[model samples]
Target: MPHTISGFSKLSKSEKIEWLLNTYFTDKDSARALVKQYWNTDDKLQKLHDEFIENTITNYYLPLGVAPNFLINKTIYTIPMAIEESSVVAAASKAAKFWLDRGGFKAEVLSTEKIGQVHFIYKGGFDKLEAFFKNVKPKLISDTASITKNMERRGGGILDIQLRNKSEDLPNYYQLHATFETLDAMGANFINTCLEQFATTFKNEALLFKDFTGDESNISIVMSILSNYVPQCLVRAEVSCKIEDLKSKDIPNPEEFAEKFKQAVSIAEVEPYRAVTHNKGIMNGIDAVVLATGNDFRAVEAGVHAYAAKDGTYSSLTHCSITDGIFKFWIVIPLALGTVGGLTSLHPLVKFSMEMLQKPTAKDLMKIVSVAGLAQNFGAVKSLTTTGIQEGHMKMHLMNILNQFEAADTEKVTLIEHFKTNIVTHSSVVEAITKIRESGNFK
Candidate 1:
């Protein structure tokens, strides 16, 4: 069994690796060689990567790709995507190209509001608590003046504060609900700092309130944190064209295709099972951009999924419709993103991605991300309703299958050509490669 050691993080890199190998591995030498093999040869870059997180080991990389020809808000852009999935970039690129000629995509930000809360318990009269809150509200705002000064200069700061009573739901539970406008920053730290200050001020003032007699004045703070749910931080992106223009060589009947697409979205809107997978396809695009830009994809994912189920049942994030000879597809999602803070300033690739995006503001980034999701959903729904998702997905996955079988360059070339007309499956590709090797074909 492995044993814990003190000062593990304080150890040098080599020492940490040595301790790890000795603690767990029988073949320490070979394991040590394998770990060192992934280290960057450039010392400075490797050092930078090592310092990015705690207990550093080595860098793990994902492919950073670009999908071109994305036209949003009348401007063309090439989006950077960092992902390991086989077909995500391809699917997004195809969708972008498809809509590029059909009026492109229109995107707009609906709002930019974020939230945080301070939960506490006070077994006090509700009316008295309300009066006390009103008395102290100005102090709560004034106490955080220093914290909000810079944000205020940038035209973004505390927006509102409210006292919410939830004693009926949970015994003596109350919350100080706060909202903020962080401008270009995600502002989790700012919101959290303000919340903690508010909590402190609330507790301090409660002890001095003359009306509170006993435990009513003894407020116990539960927690103070920023909420990942930002329903108002929403952006909308859509693509629309005349129904007649929806005709394609693969899908020749524009009217029928449009109807099928609408029905497909309708089913996802009502069915939880389909909605989960359906929204995941949208996130495959959204998350790629979010990760590439150094924003928190995990938070975006949580908030978006919650928004999808906001109506009591999980539903599709993307919607489609047809009216008066026009076919339309769109998605509106809540995304609390930043362009000026966190990894955006530290990560080299993140900085490059922001530059490539023409240094968009926070609102601009929201619109671009929304468009990515809409484009991705278009690609998925188009494939699902017509040729089936596997045809394109497996074709894109063929190279991975070939690499798994350890096919040589020449063999891979021939197989690529052969699979162009043939179906691609793990078993079929393996069997074909075996036959080619057995026949003494081009080595």
Candidate 2:
């Protein structure tokens, strides 16, 4: 019974919601009520949220949890994470506390370079195209002076541009590959603007170039955009301590634990299947911080995963080693983040998250974010090598299962105490709940 609607975007927010309810829902009143319940109580704040995106709708909420005791570079921090998944915040906190006494994490930024490209089809000889590009490269830089002026003042702007011929892969395909130094901002708009200008200037100059033939003069601009695969914008974070100092409740056998942890990382390095999940654990921390701070998690994910496979095979982003009596765990990742632009200045929670971190610049944010990923990976690998992943994960997931079964307050209290000494699983919890209900054990 689906049908198309006209001028959907032009409709008012209420009108759009009405159309959606009428078109899709069997229980329209319930659906409408549920949507309205999530809206902000303050009308002005609600209006702000609505204007953030098209087809203004109710806000989706996530728990904004903070993991404390992260001692990165001799300074303590409590990192904010906005994610729905259970156990992530707990794991990060546990890892941070564990490392707090073990010399803490050290982090540094390696680079801050971002990339963009002007992909086009030039039906011309390579030599002629090369000559035309060389002649137009300076113009490409100069023509974007208006756009680059402010960025240049902030110590970030266009770095270099080169002609890339892709004739072997496809006929008459080429690129104006460019690199940029976009200091603090993610600079998507800035990079894209520069690339479009480059494309325009290149194409316009090609038309006047005596080297290009009649067909070669027509440079077909396919697209101009920024690349999310920023391998050069990297940061490294590490934690190291003596092997004996690693002994704790979870890791009683420090030597064995160190070897096992290293072996787990090694397996992930060679096994694609294991590497994907291993890196996902790392992202649980990275993406949480990224989202909480109003940066692009998707871009970070794409870039990190690509960096993992940059060696021709997908491998672990983290590495572990034990030399002499010292145990070291580390991760180096590409994170093109910002703190002054985009959502950092707009969203209320984003501003709070930024302030909570003492208002870090892009490089400082990179170091902190990298430390988060490393801390998360360490916690995951430690759990995987010792008690296994499910025990802690299932314990954290117990409340969700309880809510799904709709257990009463008293039932929850009793069952929680009982499960403290017993195994936790869906069927077992359900069975226990059934027994309590059938026995009428309410005191």
Lowest summed lDDT across 10 adjacent residues in model 2 is found at 434-443
Worst 10 residues of 1 by lDDT: 434-443
lDDT tens digits by residue: candidate 1, 226-305: 99999999999999999999877867999999999999999999999999999999999999999999999999999999
lDDT of 1 at 186: 91
Could you tell me every candidate's TM-score relative to the true structure?
Answer: 0.97, 0.98
Q: Please provide, for model 2 over 91-159, each residue's C-alpha lDDT reduced to its tens digit, 9 standing for 90 to 100.
A: 999999999999999999999989999999987788888888888888999999999999999899999
In angstroms, give how far residue 172 of model 1 lies from its true place: 0.9
After superposition, candidate 1 runs with Cα above 4 Å error? 440-443
Deviation (Å) of 334 in candidate 2:
0.8
